[model samples]
Target: MQFRRTVIALLTLATFGTPATAEGEKAGAFDYYVLALSWSPNWCLREGDARGAPECAEGAARGWGLHGLWPQNERGWPSFCRTNARSPSRSDTAAETDIYGSSGLAWHQWKKHGTCSGLSSAAYYDLAREAYSAVTRPVVFRALDQDIRLPAGVVEEAFLKSNPDLDPDMITVTCKANQIQEVRICLTKDLIPRRCGTDVIRDCTADRALFTPLR
Candidate 1:
């Protein structure tokens, strides 16, 4: 009876995978990072306006805002991993609102992807800010004075042209409901440009994705 119970326990562990730490997977165990930049105007049009997101206010003129810096694997990603890192305080999250558009997003990013980085909350936020500054967002997008519909590849091409170090494989443009959403760039743990994993390389093929001008 004891032998049968042990065998069953082993099988359960094998099937469910071992929990190395607390109630989640071990932290700091990822291959690379994905920097996500959201087009603020488009997002406002999609869902922010309804939610009354302050970043969507008229004349905000927000272009590409930091969405998150996500820890990713070669084929998958980690989230909400167990870590001993301290959570960001309200002030810590507030400091990132300029880049993230809201303290709520900053908080969420730290809770989800940031926890998986294994870095202390402060270090993770600092790295996220650093990564955002490293990318050269295309000035052309901000020059738009009106809403327009263009091929999604145009957005990708602009990014490639603006950041010579970024190759086609290192970045991807995502769209939703025929609207341009965000530009996701893959980088090394040290924040250098790198090819994205296959799972992160999915690009939008919309021939006429709506792009809204900065407010």
Candidate 2:
């Protein structure tokens, strides 16, 4: 009898908990979206320079570039979901190069995040473009003439000041290798500002992180 009771308890625990999303699960099963904006100058200074990436060319003058529009859940996110949607054509990916830095990134974003959106490649790209346009990236950062180190919170504050609609809870700044990495904002599927999930609201507490100036 004890053995049967233990088996039943285990079944109950497995059925009721919030599980991390499995790879290649059903599409469009997420709760919200995270729009990641990468600081291009910082990327150039970090990984891009090592790879001799064209985006890091001396005169590019890149700023905040669209990273990806990731689908998120209240607890755990989905990725590389199974979908019947066709992959994006080369031209479709190329159309996004102005904001995404390369056609390859756009294609990769579609395969990873866009597949889980339940939208066709065309619709997903359109939505991604629309979300990128809605956010107001701070202009003051562009005026930076030289590298500086500052608290990561200052970057978050500047974003809040520029975008009054975004509350502190809706956005976060992340750091990598003591350099400012990406600014992530949570939004509803319809592209309205929303509070991020607990897992998504991790703010970088670094007192000083390198900020590279644009070319």
Candidate 3:
């Protein structure tokens, strides 16, 4: 298991170059978090390779799950810090595999974003899971019961209604080829509602998007 985690860690490094900070410097500490909740049905259907992804498996049918809790700045974000950090803690690896629905996904997010947060692997994952739980999903799922297609604005509004504390600016809907893919919600490090920067608001250029029924 350690060998596999090491391989995954090195592979991630190859993709995102190693950070230049001193060995003793803090890593992954950032301004805010972008809790991205992916719509599983869209991923399973549109991205065929991820068809049998556990997050969207028949028995689970998880409507939306944590894609990642990324560290972001006012302009951009941090990544690939602590070039030598090991894989997520064994405890986090086990718990997050179920929460993230894939061991690789859990490991990748921690390697990419978690290391930069300057938190221990366990604390980082605790925050990630807490962030996931802090945001309620029933409202969106309640509205998406059937196989229906709707404008992207409606989905955003539903989230706002469900989470009354959020403003129109705090959340954004992402779509691919008019299919709703994910909902990006902005929050402070302490998990309070936050407004995303203007530079990174929405993903889809489309005014309308489809919502495939949850599997």
Instruction: List lDDT for all candidates, in order.
Output: 0.92, 0.93, 0.75
- List ranges where model 3 is wrong by over 4 Å: 1-26, 48-51, 83-86, 89-91, 140-146, 203-205
- Clashes by residue pair, model 3: 27-116, 28-116, 28-117, 29-116, 178-210
Can you write out model 2's per-residue Cα lDDT over 67-95, one digit (the tens) per residue? 99999998778999999999999999999
Q: After the best TM-score superposition of candidate 3, give how far the Cα of residue 41 lies from its true spot, in angstroms.
A: 0.8
Candidate number that wins on TM-score, 1 or 3: 1
Local accuracy of candidate 3 as per-residue lDDT tens digits, 19-133: 3222223585567888998877777777633555566666566577788988777656778776345567666676786667677788888887888887877788889999888
- For 62-164, candidate 1 gives per-residue lDDT tens digits of 9999999999888678889989998999999999999999999999999889999999999999999999998899999999999899998999999999999
How many residue pairs of model 2 clash at the backbone? Answer: 0
CA displacement after TM-score superposition, residue 180 of candidate 1 (Å): 0.5
Among these predictions, the greatest lDDT belongs to 2
Position 193, candidate 2: lDDT: 93
Worst 10 residues of 2 by lDDT: 14-23
Clashing pairs in 1: none
Between candidates 1 and 3, the one scoring higher on lDDT is 1
